[model samples]
Target: MVGLTYKILPNLTAYGGYSEANRAPTPLELNCSSPTRPCILASTLISDPPLQQVASHTIETGVRGNLAIPAGGTIDWKAGLYRTSSTNDIIQLASLVLGTGYFTNVPETLRQGVEAHASLSIGAFSAYINYAYVDATYQFSGTLSSPFNPYADANGNIFVHPGDHIPGIPRQQLKVGGDYAFTPEFKAGFDVLIVGSQYYVGDDSNQNPQLPMYWVANLHASYQITNNVQIFGLINNLFNNHYATYGTFFDQTTDAQFAGNPVNFVSDPRTITPAQPIAFYGGVKVTF
Candidate 1:
């Protein structure tokens, strides 16, 4: 690993770095490489096949600075760009069997992105915002089994090509929050997170409907009661926003209509785990 930094200005600095790393395949990944003999990961191990180690190379550069407001507050901000490429990257592909998958190495994969953050402070109040944009994709061509995906070929295999967006990774994300101090002993803060949409799991071919975007907000407060004790309150999902963080294809045994027909046993393939609703909690913290 190598890195360098330069003072471009009185209150500004520039930095860049490059690094290389390698990771050996885990026991499960090393042993589960057979599509003909799928194992219920951790519960069973049927086949053992050697896999190449994953090697990653990364590069990053950025600029950071601080600015002061003559009349009131000060702002600190930084922005940067980064890219990481991995060779022989291991990936899990869903198989024809329900709730099972096998791990194999892909030729190459890439994850590149830009990130920026800024914060302001004025006397007893401070606020901050952060945002990131990512472009994650496969860099090789291959075929894998995805029986649950509607777009899979007749033999339940999907072909992944170069530049295909990887499943379950959002392209854009943002967060904004603020904190205010009513007094030395009392303070409160709130934050909202926004996430962009991406392809669902098992949609490695980029042929299925992508997940929808969603946002969530939360609030928190704290009061110092003594030198060693304090009280706090939290409210999650402030607006009771409905959302799902993860989604995948599932095989349903029964159809929606339930018409007592033996042949109609395929319901919606999309399955999701819902996010939490509006909830509140209070607690005490001791510094002892």
Candidate 2:
């Protein structure tokens, strides 16, 4: 990795960086190669058909500055752009069994994004906002065959086309928050986070319905009782909005069962886990 930074003005700075990274496959990926002989949990499995490591190259650039406000406060802002490409990217393929999957490698993948944030403070009151937009997609064309492919035909094969959006990754997100100091001993703040939707796993062809976007709110407060003692409280998921951070659809039933008496059994093909509900936490901090 390499980086460079230059001060363009008294309060402004510009920076850029480049990095290369690699990741080796795990033992599970190396061993799980055939769908016919699925390894159940708690069973012994040996690594077979060694896998290749994934290699990535990335570049990023950004600028940030602080501006003095007429009211004796200051505003800080920054913006950045980044791009990364990876070869032989390892990915998980859903299996016929629920909560189980195998790993495979894509020929290539790309992710590029923009990010910006700004914060303002005028006296005890302050506010900040941040936003990011990502374009993540596969850069290779091929066919993926798996027992869990939701779009598979009778033979269980799904075609992966270039530019398919990777599943479970939000393409856009935003966060805005502000805090006010009631006094030297007390403060309160709140924040809202928004996440955009993307394609679902097992639907790499981009033919399935995408997950819906959602947002959540959070609140926090703090008070100091003495120079060395303080108390804080937090309430997350203020509205209790239901959402899922990750999700995928697959047929959880085995092939033999489906072939024997397909009409005698009913299966819920889509599985989803819900996000945490509204919760509260409080704590005290003490310093010597």
* Candidate maximizing lDDT: 1
Clashing residue pairs, backbone N/CA/C < 3 A, model 2:
none
Candidate 1, 29-125: lDDT as tens digits = 8888878777776556666678899999999999999999866889999999999999999988887877678888889999999999999999989
TM-score of each: 0.92, 0.85
| Model 2 weakest 10-residue run by lDDT | 35-44
lDDT of 2 at 283: 100
What's each prediction's clash count? Answer: 0, 0
Candidate 1 has its poorest 10 consecutive residues by lDDT at 252-261
Please give the TM-score that candidate 2 achieves against the real structure. Answer: 0.85
Where model 1 places Cα greater than 4 Å from the true spot, the runs are 41-47, 254-261, 265-267
